[model samples]
Target: MSARDSATVRIDASDTLRFNALMPGELQERARMRARPDFPWVARQAAITLSEAYRGNLLLTRLLNDRGRVALALLMLDMHFEQPDAPGLTTGRLKAEAVALDICSPGRVGAILAAFRLFGLVAPAPDLDGRRRRLVVTERLLAIHRERWRTILQSLALVLPEEGERGLHHIEDPAFLAAFVHALLEPMRAGWRPAFDVPAIAHFADRDGGMLIAFALFGTGPTGQPLSISQLARSFRISRSHVVGIVQNAAEAGLVRRVDEQGSRGPGVLPQPALTEALEAFVALVLVRQAVAVRRGLAAIGVA
Candidate 1:
């Protein structure tokens, strides 16, 4: 469904109301933004920005790519800001928070944090209370977060120039970044997903390396060559079978189709209209949500 088609497509009233509960008037805002005449081009530009940023940091990106890992990373930063003087990001606390968000299991949190430590994204902090290990968000982690935020703000800037530019300018300011993270996480804690409105790619967004695949597919225009399973697996550092499984499931869901049904043509997957529209709309909605967060962050620092 293209943005134009979204104008005519019937949205479930209940879903709109549910989303609106978290971000007031967000569903309507997303609809309006998506309905814009220039939205398609903006979405494409934003997709390129996102794709380049994702590819720029392959290892850390892979570690923090999925829905669960993303939530965990942001939650750690949020808690760290909330209590800079105290032990905020303990394994137990993080695990409980992850469980509350229903995005990951406690055991998974442990493994993710271990990977963070192993990758030098986080380090041990002094335990003020003499019990429970405390982890501090390292500068490496902060740099990764800043790059991610900057990439999103750059994409958002394409659609809403002033707000996005302002965010990009003040992103390095501790106050602005702290406020932005809080604003971004509040809705997420309430279970607002970036691709929630587009159900076709919801599963993709949730899985590890799944979203990268979706974005790569969306970047390939009608004339561009499709991505093969081997390409995706190598690019994302995931197993070949994993890519095959993801593509197979997406094909079953009508999100993608094999370029050549017969073995003679080769092994590449094409993004169907379902995927293109969903990915475009996903980009639009994310920019809309980020605009809201940017305003909140800007407002916190007394910026208009």
Candidate 2:
């Protein structure tokens, strides 16, 4: 099977597991709701991280997908935010959390857990049901987390140079740690839906490679700049032809248009005004909503 086909099939398998949701996506929706009162900080952290990545050129769908897979793996080891005062989180509960967060499926979650066991990132432990398997987070994964933290800090520096190194933390701060856990994942907001939503995508009907291609434009080719297919392919790690196809698709989809009398504008892929407007509007909405979530959540944490 083709790589794209294989990936789509895997996503389809996850969709099947999600069929049991209370109402199509009840688990994810309820998780967002439950999070509001109990874990507002988590939601806000996710929003901030996503916004930062979007406004900057550091994130892509491939990186976002990898982060989701890693998040599921870490959840298996209960390495989410590392708050000792809170109760322990089990693998089973984490699977439920994944569903509730609309991040992944129980099957995908189990696959990551099993992979971690094979990689020695976790060790098997005795369970109440002796035959059942349970795993603990190992030091190796902690080390990996440290490395990932440094990488994020570096990426932040590229875009948010003004912040310098002050925002970097030792993973002990709950808010800082929470941001790491959700560096690539975006929060699912209600009523703000658009046909082509998701800030990760410069423009798209849904999240896909096309979206990733669009995202690359920001990192490599900002608005009003002349972006060549070769430049986009090299920057995004995709083929030149593929980038051309995506540009054509985006143009056909009305996310982009041509300059110079609907003809070639010197081998450049121009971003449409509508897409820029849409993204700006989306970012504004996120900052506003996340501010509210943060303000209300602060009282609970005694951080007024």
Winning model by lDDT: 1
What ranges in model 2 sit over 4 Å off? 1-79, 82-172, 175-212, 215-223, 239-245, 258-267, 289-300
| Candidate 2 residue-wise lDDT, 13-69, digit = tens | 444354333124434433344334423332223333433343323223333224355
Q: Write the per-residue lDDT of candidate 1 for residues 1-304, one digit (tens) a residue.
A: 2222222334366756776876888767778888889887778776666666676466555798876788889899887777557558788999988898776898889888888899898898877578778888898889988987788888777668888899899988888877888887887786655555677766476666888888888877665677778777777777878778788888877889887553553588888888889988888777887888889889989997
Best candidate according to TM-score? 1
lDDT for 285 in candidate 1 is: 75
Worst 10 residues of 1 by lDDT: 1-10
Clashing pairs in 2: 27-100, 28-100
Clash count, candidate 2: 2
lDDT of each: 0.78, 0.45
Candidate 2 C-alpha RMSD relative to the actual structure: 10.6
Give all TM-scores, in the order shown. 0.89, 0.48
- What ranges in model 1 sit over 4 Å off? 1-18, 85-87, 261-265
